[model samples]
Target chain A: MSCFILEQAGIDAPETLADVLAAAETIRDAGIMQHPVAMVSGAGWNLAQEFVNLYLGHGGSFFEPGSAAPAINNDAGLATLEALKALTSFSNPDYLTFDSNSIQALWEAGEVALMLHWGSRGAGILSGDNAAPEIVEATVLAAAPTVEGQSRPATTLWWDGFTIAANTSDADAEASFLAMLNGITPERVAANSELAVWLGEGYQPTPASAGVIASAEGGAAPYPMTPYMGLMHTALGDNLAGFLQGTASAEETLETIEAAYVTAARAQGFLN
Target chain B: MKHRTFFWFILPSLIAMILFIALPVGSVFVQSLHVEHEQVLRTVENCGPFGCTEETVIDRAATEELRAAQPLGRFAGLSNYTDRNHLAFSELGVMWERSDSFADFTRRAMTLPFWRAMAFTLTFTFVVTPLVLLLGLAIALGVNALPRAFRGPTIFVSLLPMIVTPLIGSLILFWMVDSRGVLGAALQTLMNDPNLSLKASPTLTWIMLMVYGVWSSAPFAFIVFYAGLQTVPEEPLEAAMIDGASRWQRIRYVVIPHLMPLAVFITLMQLMDNFRVFEPIVGFQAQANATSLSYNIFNYLRGDAAQFGAAATTSMLTILGVVVLLTPVLMRTWRDFNRKGH
Candidate 1:
């Protein structure tokens, strides 16, 4: 929304977080961006919330052994929500009604210009899935989204892996079966790992995956996968709507979230 | 016949209920009291000044063996129920103690997942039920008054909303109300605002969802009331006409009295169904604005461990809540039945 806002006003891409925030004002004033559509809701709202948080540099694992708690209640969190309010203004009016598939459909249908779709899944614009050929061709594998003062984009890392069951009567057999299932064979990766950016040993990235991998190298950061992480994500996802809609202040939202996570972590035995 | 004979006659149904409903409910209650865990066994290697190293490996097999031995893990009792996911009893108490007034308490408590879901569930149930009943009753009365030739087609048209599956129906409506969809575009133009959208605003989304609940469920209500209207006695109509009662009076007193039982039946059924609202939340992706108790359970069930503990807690709470909501209706129906000597 901000990008379009800047373009319409004959301005350039923002150079700093302050500029990006200003661009939000420009768009809000222009009445060109659909702000309500941007606060997409539902089961996957957690992903959307995290996508916003990545901008303020409050993401990654909530449990890093020595860290006291999930880091969603601090300065980074408040900053993220502030930036989030600005960017979410550009989402379509039906954003809260979108799931992964619907969001993808919106992009494919050209109903939306910018969406924080998954890297592997988002690659569809560059390859298949009926994305506008012009947009697809112009698609660039860029670094993760970043905040002005932050060195890295507030992006989350993810992958799929298998854990062989050791309780099986034949551990070795189970391990071998799981290995096969995981596509340890080079041929399997060549044929089927086209959607994956990185694969295990013996598997190679597909042409599409290779490009994304090359671009993301030393760029994206892993999401903090702590025990209390789910609790925190639930807190953020559940409360974000209230804050975004202006029913709750940013401070109230953060405090409520912090209290919820602390209580959950303690109850779930994640905290002493 | 002795009571034993009556019991024997119903024994098969009793057994089936025990197996399907009773057993599952019992198991869920038990599940709510215990957390399931898969043990982790890791090994470490040590390096000494003597330059010798030994290995300790994760005993994955042992961990699985242990898990298999104690599948339910340790029993946590009511902890899961009081845990932050469901009741958040401890959290609520703490927040309450810290807060200065009811407004503050409410502000803080609304943050709890259970309270939030409860608020939506209660609001939706209360809002949708009356609206559905009213729409259904109106349609029934209108259809009943229509000429015989027109009634059939009108009835068919109304039945379409009720007959289509809820998820599919909601999706179809969702697309239409989408900002770019036909209705959405028309609405935007009609309002003379380019940014107007139904699905975007929290209030608008709730209204849309409630409208959907009525649209989809009203047909069932219409069907029931239409069938009930057939039983409205001609004697009362004749008596009312002779007494110079208005057409409105005839319906207000005579037609409604006749449909009371059916109204009770529909209200009880819808209240229960709406209280457990889940599919619309998923189909509409409206969790940002609306969530029901069943959806809360569903969210947990989709988690890594199946979140059996939390899901069961929510399920048990929902079941109890349904029982609470139905108690009066059930008693009223029973009283009516006994009075009717049925």
Candidate 2:
């Protein structure tokens, strides 16, 4: 969808999804040519290419790619893609790459236009030099795109919470835990921004309980809590690395990684 | 008067060692047994506008939650040392069972990374030790053979790398191995391939790491061997040469035996240093899998949540492994030294 928007906007060339994928392969094989794709992890590289394929496959245009979905199907997918492309190409022609640390550095340097980073990244970026105070002025968080014309974007939520050990001998353990939980309120969330910059876009408060921390702000999407997250993360990271390094074709890499992920999930009883 | 002077001569070093070395080791042992936690609290006065309360106190709890999460007894004996808990078969998928016992937890936490690291450390020790020794011996011999005027400069040059901090050497290696750095640029230019990455392939990563390791280490070995070479008896080598022995034969029979003790001493030092190889591995792994045992230990200790107990157990196991592996060499060296003394 983003590719279609890019094509429609004259940001990306028009080509069929298959042709675009083939072209991406050719470019990848040419290996870090005009602009090296700076993928944060192997999973990211796979997802990026997968996204390009999905966009082109949906009858998206090459020229003004971002306009394709909006023109052909009256969808906002092209608009979203255009927004993302505009973000990536804001300061430079280089494709946006997501390395947790490097992206933080870029944000601090005020070099990044549109950074797709964690909530923590936003915080760090804002705190770095305070050069671009406007970035945090009206920060908004949106779910990532799922498919063309899809109204809801699939937002990735990473839940980190404190759990009390059932056998905790410390008499004050529960009290301390409760205090910490109480400290996680919206006011505390705002205060936390002073300590560390979270992108502040999707800042929300949740119950200080040991479950999924859903957003206090309505319309915020939550991540599914699953036991297989660790394995998925590892597999995704490996595949992303392999793709970025050109060790495997993007399609092959994705298929292999996704299959492995499924097998792991099944073994872990995450799937039957 | 002489006895008093001797005591005075060694007293400073003894005091320094007691203060710097013995004290730190003792402190670490003490710290390992006790759990430490830091809690921050804003006093009513400091809390500005918050009413003061005598009961206002914040306490932080630091305990081993993962182990305590089960109905496991505290400090259970060697029951935690079994196969079920062990990570020896982790690659076989035995260790990944969801409902792991406390022993299994300990095994996974302490044993797996420990053994893996020990194996890597051992491999690193064996590979690097001999190379350093042989290279050092060669350089020492070459320098020793040089005209006395050139020997000083040559020895100084050999000592340069050793004199630099290992961390600095590692940092330099990191830059050199970076894809956009000197060695990578040179390789790219030579191969006419811009995409060639020294860190991308595991084999290449290892090769670069080994090269950096050898480069950083060779100087130390050379310095030791050079110093040892200075003690080599000239008469025996001269006699061997006078007896129509070739240069190689003279070196083989006379010089080598003369330098054997020093060579062994240098080898042992190299082995110890290389076994705990951490800095280079850390630098290398920023772009590649050059992780060594020490680096793994460091990572485990500095992980998101510091698993102190596990870290302690791992450290203990690492110490034990090193002792076990090096015992024979240490004994042999001791016995050889005793025999030579006699």
Candidate 3:
């Protein structure tokens, strides 16, 4: 479930994107923290995923049916970028350098009041020794906030599994599959329910899994799965920084992303 | 040495170089001229923990068959070199024709990946190389002037930057320059600006990267100059001293002349090293502000889908760039060698 991990002592948990932004200002003004939000804005798939999550929350589609061409240069994209720029405005000044590790560090250190982080990190922050006790005690996992007038959470579902190599012999493949199955047996899942938001049988919901489950129940979309999506993600990650840096306009940034994606797609033989 | 004996002695290294260097370059050139096969796409129902959705996936079996038919993929000829991701000839032409001023043209051109990397690479190489040489020479002189009792410790301390691995050294600096870090807070206080962030502004980021480059590489130049300083003949120093030359004058007259060749050696190495700056960019997370040809190659080759063709083209172009950059220094050295041979 995509949920906001908040320090309850600072502000009430937010239910919508508007609430999140509002709370961000309140947290800053109250001096609970310098920045209320910490996000991954650096170049990587993580940044692209963050953009896609917001873009999808605004009811945007990546492409039209049967088209490899990107169609994100639209109102949804502009709104997404604007929203991102706004969100980042209240974030740490060095938010551009934030990655998976740094943002978690900020959270554990109780340096930030709120974050949109993976549910998997919940256990480590809550039960792990590193996090400040004040933060751990006050931490509340709520459903992922949504864009204005949107009921669906602005997040995506991810699944981790093992796949056997195609060239492996049938006997070896069978053994590998059985071993994987045994490893994830219902007993194991029940024992490790707090570790992650597991979907299979014998999994019991915990506070750590609340955000992800709430997100799933709220109709969050899965990440886009297509042959050329990786290229588009890379293009977005590389080009979106200019707009965030205040060097380029939103429209110009979108156009550049489109051009960059087309160039990569052509090289990869996804486009003429 | 007899020609036959020379050939036999050098034959082992010749074979090794051909096998290691020449063959790899040849393979990269070939790879750069080709791109992946056009993928066969099909819509399939993907069922997982969530639910079933019709997903667009590359038809793996068909693609494998295509690959089996033609292992090297589709030959792109010179197209890969000329693509927008590479030289971007067409895009450059458009920018050139549309822009009113040189600065406008340069600004538009910097938006392209190749040119952007080139700009930073060239700037870093030019800025860091000279700075390293000067700093290195200064440090060498300063250390050399120290008393024998302190010389060993001073030399060791000066060599500390070079001893630390480049990535770790840069990472340590990266943390220190964070907005909340020691250096960063001091800078903010010094400037009386609470919002000034080294990672925020492109210009500051460039300065930071170049500073790191010079800091990390100066020791190489220093040690070389220091070693060269040891061999400076005492006779010239005495002659210059007897001529009533000042300490500065003595160094300028005798010591510098003795160290000129070492300066050339250091400059050549620094230019080559600085041109391929990669670790600091990664460590500092400065890609949004600065990137180099080596970094671009790394970007292309990493992640879920590796762009082998793009990486290969960048590699070939990087080799070409290194050669072009070293040409003047190499030419001067060749001329000097020829003159001496005569």
Candidate 4:
């Protein structure tokens, strides 16, 4: 759930994550907010991880192509996990088990005050009767991602794309299909009710895409891509969960991640 | 002449087994000997005033050429079997030398991912198989004692677990046990702890998974045991009751001996089935707590790049485990057949 606020808070935008947290805490203290904040985990934790990476000024990227080993135990990794704990301090207790859908549901049910989630899921909140009724038309998105030391909000850029089968019978037809998808007119966007696609190249952000769009405008770095990225995701998600559950200390958790990656890399024939 | 005719009649089944079972197994064994290919990359180092910098590049064309020559990459010659993820003998060796006691060594070794999966697999099979048999037998005996009119509905209701697909069944159980769901809420209130989650502890998660396994498979056992109960001759019950035997004695002496064959059948089939448990791990989101050999194979085949070699090795090992589990049962059946013929 990304923060949605009416202009009545006497603020143009939340300048940092702290601003949103402080405001939520104050409102919660005044007995105003029901659900303080809902943090998403499981696959949806990628968004939170990337946001924390930005906030912590992580000096290294795990997904860089050809990087031989993971730097998951580094200072940036530890700092990001610490920051993640703070961000989710007031979240739903079941956040460990929450996928993107459940977190989105929390926000939709009006149980959550704010959350950082995909704009697609968050868009319904700005509609009728789902959440804080007063902010139906008053919602404002933050313009940038916030970095720990940096003034701007840094985010990793991401989007889903499509491809055609190389063995298609008609190359001409496939090429035309690609062209039609790319060259959709505003009329087409309206007719199809396409929210995620480029609307005649002006790049308007839907409620679902707002967090990501803001990150892009703020010059968020591209998401990391490495040979063992799938393994890394599994390693990070599984081990980081242990730390969250307090089953293992942060150091032991990081060590577990490092060992897992090494073993996986060896299995994949990346190492001797 | 009868035997020869029977051979001709079974020729198609033999051919089917060769093609479907033997061929796939043979291929897996071969694949295990060949490692999954990695993109062959060549590195370049540029010397400069600022200390030489190195870069690695995937030589796609060269890789394709190399692949074209030996398609499955290099012949691993059992090296894949010995690799850290598979045999893990080397890691075990390292842990063994460092640890003081056998218990300490096992604890360290179980931390290895492969060994961890093995522990879950063995635990699930041994635990669930008996559970299915016991629960099944209990339900069968209870239902059998009921009036004839009620037996039909009870049997139908009992078989419901096997009716749904395993994955769907597991998902339903998972949702019901979710910390926010009804059962989870009930457990929390019962324990008087507001935040008790079944998934919080590794031991609790494993126990929950095993319980789900038994609950899901108990019906199969119940049905089999129910069918076995029908064949218990009325004469034997009359004889046992006339001998002044109690109801429990009648079951222990007469009913159980008659049900031994069906029990053996269930044991053999269930051992093989339970040994390959996979779905509940995904449903329970217990990949962090438990993993079976089948799940271990799936892990290798799951990503952007499938490590088919590791999957193949795990598959072969899984087949070996199933074979080992079956051997005693097969020998017992053979011995019983010989005694009957004599």
Candidate 5:
């Protein structure tokens, strides 16, 4: 699961996207931190994933019902892009080069006060040798802020599970399933609860797991599982940077993404 | 040599080329003409730790039945090449018809992935090839002029860029050119602009990629020319010296002519290598700013749902690009060979 990880030393935790943006000026004016937010707009699929979180927060869906036609070139899409551009105004100038690894580095170095990252990174941030002591002590995990009138946090839900291969024998599949079941038993889950935000019985919530739990309880939607969503993701990842760079408008960028997705969908037989 | 004897001598290599090179390319061409069958979709409850939600999933049994019946997938013909992700012929026509000016047309065209990658690839190939040749020749000459005792260390030091792996070299440079990194900080101070980020701008990223291309590849041309320098006989030099030629004149006259063939060889190799530029873009994570045909193919094949048809089409297009780029050099070499024979 992913949610907002904020450094609380400089300011109270932001509860809404407006609060986050509003806090940026106060933090900068008071000489607390120049950039309060760290977002990825440049490399990898994380940017697209983040975009989906923001778009869904604005009540947007990826496709028309029962079809592969893209429905993102709408008001929600434009609002999401505009919000992202506003957030970037308070982020580092080198935000275009930001990816998972680099943003994590910035967080650990205490350069950025807020970031949206995976909960699995909690262990490293809490006890990693590279992280500054003050930053570690001040770090707080919370559900990502939502847009106005939205109760759910601006984030998506994800889960990790085990599955047996189709080619495995019946006996082997049974053994594999038994092993996985044993691994996630209540007793074992209680013992290793701090390692992750576990959903197994007897697992207790820790500060590190707070964000994921809160987000799940707040009705964060799961990422879309449509077959053609992968193509949409690739198109979004490839094209969104142009808008963030100020070279393309939100409409133009969304149009490019739709065109790209349609072409890829046609090639993959998801569209004619 | 007898024709039959020559044919028998090259028989092993000919078979190896056919098996390794020709067959794979032929299969890629065939794959480019087909696409996956239309998927059968079904809504199912996907239970997980975070409760069950109705999700759209591929109906595996139905899809598998379709695949089993027609294993090669639905035939797509040349539609993959004409799609917006590849050549984008129809999109280009739209851009031409709708745009108000030539610059507007070009700007709209660059928004297409195929044209965007092509712009970077062609620019990288054309810019880096000549720079590599010039820098390599300069280094070769400077090293050749060094004292015999210092030459060994100098040559070794100069070859370090090529000796280091390209990916690692680019990654190190990527770090150094970060906004807060040593080189990046120094560049910012020098330019008197706090916001001068090398990775943020497309033009800067293109320049950095080409700079890396030249830095890593110059050593290859240098070593080739250095070896050729050793073979430049003393007879012409002595004659030129006796005829009152200056040092620059001697080099311009005799040394350059002797190195002409080696320059041609280096140019041929460099053009092919630069046209397929891939590693540095990935290492630097510059895909947002610059992507080559090879990078496009890599992108198509990556992630959960690999577009095999798109990847194959890009592969064929890349092969075609390399052939077109090399044709002039190949024809010139052939003409030179014929002239010498005559």
Candidate 6:
């Protein structure tokens, strides 16, 4: 969806590595420098790095922040790299680290050119009468792009859901639990959207709740919750923090992160 | 008759001890051991139900495979200990390798959180104790000297924080220190700087925490010292004043010594309380700069995998650190108690 919009706005949307490089050359040739890109802090960092490497590999430049990134190759950093790979390969390359609070500030200030953020953050940007319209204008979800001939855009769903613990003693609770799960009706979902607005702007319900949420106001894609989510988050956060701080090169960061994920998987009994 | 009386006297306490203290401690110890061997025990138990049954005979190979896959063992030996190798070392090798030696684990465990907590505890004790002591003493002296009509109101004012719940006090502090809070706004207004947010900078955070700590704690000290001041012999203060001593001299020479015992008591109590500073820090911002040792231990214990053995080790180390730091002051108090013999 983002690619479609960008393409309509005359921005060439690249799907593959080779195409991305060609797009980079075209942009550079047109004397239009890529502006600052926002990345979610922590696990999002690794994804950002992968994205950066893909871009840089195709002849793009990265904007280094004030602090020197740390030197990586630590076990933790390697784990982060691995976690990033396991999650998604379309890591946003040119990204800046921002927590929810920092992102809110950046969005309000219109400081960031692009942001790859949770759908809920949009509600926050829209909330409070004082919120700047420019933030709403600038914000766009990072949807997966289709290659030149592809018809549909791929959207990742980030979902937070409830599950019964294996050790839950009350077997009878399942009926009530299923009822409660089903109770998130369209009305309830719309109410939740309002509640999210009250809580903070940029808050959006999961995509599954979108049909219900769309009735109230702002809503977007809900990222899926994968088993490797936590590991990916931690790895990305640590590595990206390291990269932004200038401690690790993009390649070293990615490689080290990949190794770390392998180790973590093994430790968790997921790998042989 | 005396034996019967002694038995009656001891039995209640004995039962209470077994039911409350002893039972809980024993359970915790067992739980600690289980935590130590968690993985192996899980693996073994995953095999099948404990103690084979007739049903197991029907599918021996399947059950055996299931059991192997599950892992079942009452005792996992050092498997649990090995997973916690990170707690021992500042930097472990990048590979997923367990520590080769228990000695390394023991050494690392002793230093990281244990020593760091100790240092924080010591700083907390030192900073809060003397400040509370002096402030409390001053409030006590002032209250004691107040006219009889105003005395009650003043004492009540000093006792307000003590009467209010600590949790509530912490909440109040949280609001006050919050960037969008009233206190933050007041500070910003007074400083005439819009950008000066309390929670943003480390220095401001420390100041806010310290102020909150003193505000919530000074009252207790004030109440104790005020009571102590009431008991101070008036004759010495009168004598000092008659001897051409100024108010400062009279306080320095006469009042402080008279209040020494009470001061020592308050100091010891405050030292212990401040060393275990937990709730306030926890209630403060999630990533606030006010992390004390107790909070760190609590956070570590509350992680996804509750590392009880690690928690126990950390707890023991914290106790040791406190004892080491407080021994000298405790000894002085002991001597003072013996001398007073009350």
lDDT of 3 by residue, A149-184 (tens): 887898877768788898999999999999999988
Per-candidate Cα lDDT values, in order, are 0.69, 0.48, 0.86, 0.70, 0.87, 0.49
Worst ten-residue run, lDDT, model 4 chain B?
A: B46-55
Taking all chains together, the TM-score of candidate 4 against the true structure is 0.85
- On DockQ, the candidate that comes out on top is 5
Sort by lDDT, top down from the best: 5, 3, 4, 1, 6, 2
Candidate number with greatest TM-score: 5
Candidate 6 segments whose C-alpha is farther than 4 A from its true place: A1-118, A121-157, A160-272, B1-115, B179-197, B286-290, B339-342
Predicted candidate 4 versus true structure: per-residue lDDT over B1-342, tens digit per residue:
599999999999999999999999999899988864555666776442223445555666876787898876668798777867767888789879978999878766665667888999999999999999999999999999999999999999999989989899888888888776789888988999866778756788889999989988999999999998989999999999999999999999999999999999999989999999999987876776677899888877866667788789899999999999999999999999999977
How should the candidates be ordered by TM-score, best one leading?
5, 3, 4, 1, 6, 2
Residue B82 error, candidate 6, Å: 11
True contacts kept of 2: 0.00
Expressed as tens digits, the lDDT of each residue in B256-299 for candidate 2 is 88777777777677777777788876555432234465665565
Clashing pairs in 3: A1-A211, A1-A212, A1-A213
DockQ, every prediction: 0.34, 0.05, 0.67, 0.25, 0.72, 0.08
Best by lDDT: 5
The CAPRI category of model 5 is medium
Identify the superior model by DockQ, candidate 4 or candidate 6.
Answer: 4
Regions of candidate 3 where Cα sits further than 4 Å from its true position: A1-11, A166-170, B97-101
Better of 5 and 6 by TM-score: 5
Across residues A32-121, which tens digit of lDDT does each residue of candidate 6 receive? 433223444423333443433222222222211211122233433343343333222222221222355654565465543334445456
lDDT per residue (tens digit) for residues A136-209 in model 1: 55343443446765655555556665556656568787767877776656666666566566445555655445
- Residue-by-residue lDDT tens digits, candidate 1, B281-323: 8777788777778988887666432466777889999999999
Arrange candidates by DockQ, highest first: which order?
Answer: 5, 3, 1, 4, 6, 2
- Cα TM-score per model: 0.83, 0.56, 0.96, 0.85, 0.97, 0.58
Q: Provide backbone clash counts, one per model.
A: 11, 28, 3, 10, 0, 51
How well is each residue in A1-272 modelled by candidate 4, as lDDT tens digits? 23343232333345566665665665466565534666556522353354334433445466334555766677766766665666566665556566677776666555665665544554565654566664444444444336456644544444454456555679777787878786666566655442563424455556545665666566555444444566666566545665665656667667777777676666565654
